[model samples]
Target: MLGRRATILSFDLDYPALYYPADSGSLAGQRRFVRATRVRLFALFAAALGGAWSWRAGSFDLFGLLGFVAFAIALGAATYLQATDPARSWYEARTASESIKTLTWRYIVGGDPFPLSLPETAAEKLLRARLAAVIDPDKLPAPSPSAPTKQITDRMRSVRASSFEDRRAAYRDGRIEDQRGWYARKAVANERLKQTFTWVAIALELAGFVGAAFKAFGQVDVDLLGVFSAAAAGLAAWTQARSYADNQRAYSRNAYELGLIADELDGVSKADWPRFVDEAENAISTEHTQWRAAKGLGAPRQRNAASAPES
Candidate 1:
């Protein structure tokens, strides 16, 4: 009973508790850092050119010295940003969180070790070992302990603890339908964002080109060229950092795969529940592991979270 309850809590709260924050944090950190760095690079480039232009035009003065100082400062800031890399920390946590989520789903649905034929204590030991394989020894950024009320606890009792029909319905509703809906929405949203960013980047680049042409013909001040160039460069940086096109593709692919799995799940039999859930969990794990790999989240502690169980 206790082991089952633990599995219940892990699925209901623990996985989410880690995944949500880490996912959001990673995106925000990387986006912000990229944007700032781009702006800094633009400023440094603009100042250097402006300084040279001023010197050659005999408008010399303190401008050249100031530009050099600004360039040095930007270089130092970039170094600091590279050294800190807040995005790396978030990526690491995200990897860990997703790995944990896969394990949680497998446990909740009685995917393997928690099969109907297994003893409760042995099932518990297997789950512990599997979890140990992925979770870091240090508890840093671990999911906060749950504080579920009796009402919540009873409602979230393990699917394994439920009636056969209830278990089937839980799988269909929670794993299949909910996942399909979520991923489908994400795919659409990501595609939309990708289009928007691509257009914005193109528009910004065109504006810069127009500004440069105007400067070349002496219709606009040379200074205006720098401003437009900086804007375009920064926008390009944002576009690259967001990687909207790649995200749209990934989300779309995952949604399609999950949709297929959801369709297959409708015909699963009670006698084949173990294999059905195992395959379902495997599908989920495969997509997420690919996601981590694409992001270069680094070699994970458990090596692709070893989506395949070890014992």
Candidate 2:
């Protein structure tokens, strides 16, 4: 029993870690890439401003050199850190992580293909194979073998082998309740991002108008008006690049869907419990898979992201 528990726990940790790599590993690569990309973008804009300032001040050499360096840095980031790709890594990693999560949910709930009629060893092998096939290496390669281990607590194993009431309660708290909260929070976040970026873009446009007015009255150089225009354009470009509005709409829709799912599961009958679990888990996986496809990250595969394992 001891050995069996360890084996199950190890697989739980290992499979999720295969592509996405849970815990701090998830944040590290993404954080590094985001910061690096931002640095490069800021430098590019700063370079444009510097060049304008240099021309106005007749200090050509210094600003020209700065602009060249900024351009080079942006190119380097695009090449090495994949700075040009918007949310590709995020979507890929998140898809893999969520797929593993769905697999675990189905396994614990003992719904559909889980709790095989086959022997323990064969069942475990099938589970791992199905999971491995789900991870798409085309978007993001697998993590290093030396990737940090995920600590599998006693709860995952116990829950997997638990009684009906225990499993149902765990599903109630961990799946339905938790997912509702997550969807709500993410919806709010996306809305906030959209609203904030929209306001910032409007402010930039106002600034540009003010600058253009001043230049028309000959109160400032025409070149200064160009600076404000560039800033306004940059704000609009950034808003589109981030897809803040689209994400806001998507999150809002998903949150409403999850709310309905949660409500339907309230006091579910045992006879109908398995089907409920099936629908709930499928809803979660389908949401992520749809998000993946919207972002164009996992659409090229012969198998849809949800069908890869969770379907």
Candidate 3:
């Protein structure tokens, strides 16, 4: 019975209207920020190389022109970064996306502050209010004209109206297990990325050291040291910006925590289910809180205290 119902019900179809737009905005902003940062780094590296080459060439017009163009590219990238502030957009949009996603899961699973005992009308109203409270209109992009209008879908209502066993099964399988798998995958990916970047940085440093040694022996007419040094510095800056190591640690911790929470789900009674769900949600929220903190977004909002429905 639970398997049949789960097959029919879909979280994607029932997600709130605002979530898609916020998610899109977050992704676009992230891409823009990454592209701009890379462009700036590359431009600076080119400028350093150009300057070094010009010096070695005794102020040749061609090398001077290359340096001028490189500086111009760097300046343009910096100006674009300042004007767009893609990082801020990415963070705020991500906040809205995650908040809506968490609330949607809570509502569908009949979790705390959105229990199945509440009247349907009251529950919908509370969900809407909570959604509004979490989203800042000015920070997020406008919803597309084709975006879904219904915030609470019929599938969501059906899931909420399911028996305790079905609801528990659905939440456990759909939410907890899914999230745990995602976190585990992300942790592995981030760890690989961290190691890759670290090795690349080390290689660049070694190259710079070799260039310096060669320069000291007067074996090369052109100074490769300055160029390699600039490349190393750029790699370091990019690695810091990516925060691969931090994300790897955070994702691994969250994956383990979610595994533990999933283990506790089977023993929860109907009466204790709501509290258990809240606890699980809190664990998930902790990961997001760490994410926001790493991005310098201050503390997570007190969602239960600030947006809980009135008795």
Best candidate (score: TM-score)? 3
The backbone clash count of each candidate, in order, is 0, 0, 0
lDDT of 1 by residue, 1-311 (tens): 11122223123433423344444555566665776576566667656554544443356456666677767767775776788675565566566656656655666566664676676556655655565566553432333355221211233335567777777676677666666676778888878888886788678677778878888898865555566566666666656766777767777777788888777876777778788787777776665666667778645667323343334
Off by over 4 Å in 1: 1-77, 137-139, 142-157, 303-311
Off by over 4 Å in 2: 1-29, 55-61, 81-87, 115-123, 136-154, 300-311
Which scores better on TM-score, 2 or 3? 3
Quote model 3's TM-score.
0.90
lDDT of 3 by residue, 1-311 (tens): 10112232343335777777778788889999999999999999988887777443555667667778999999999999999999989988888888887898888887887877788778888888888777777777775566676777787888888888888888887888888988999999999988998898889889888988988999876668888889989988888888889888988999999999999999999888777888899899888888889899987463444454544
TM-score of 1: 0.73
Worst 10-residue stretch by lDDT in candidate 1?
1-10
Off by over 4 Å in 3: 1-13, 55-60, 300-308
Give all candidates' CA lDDT scores.
0.61, 0.61, 0.82
Q: Number of the top candidate by lDDT?
A: 3
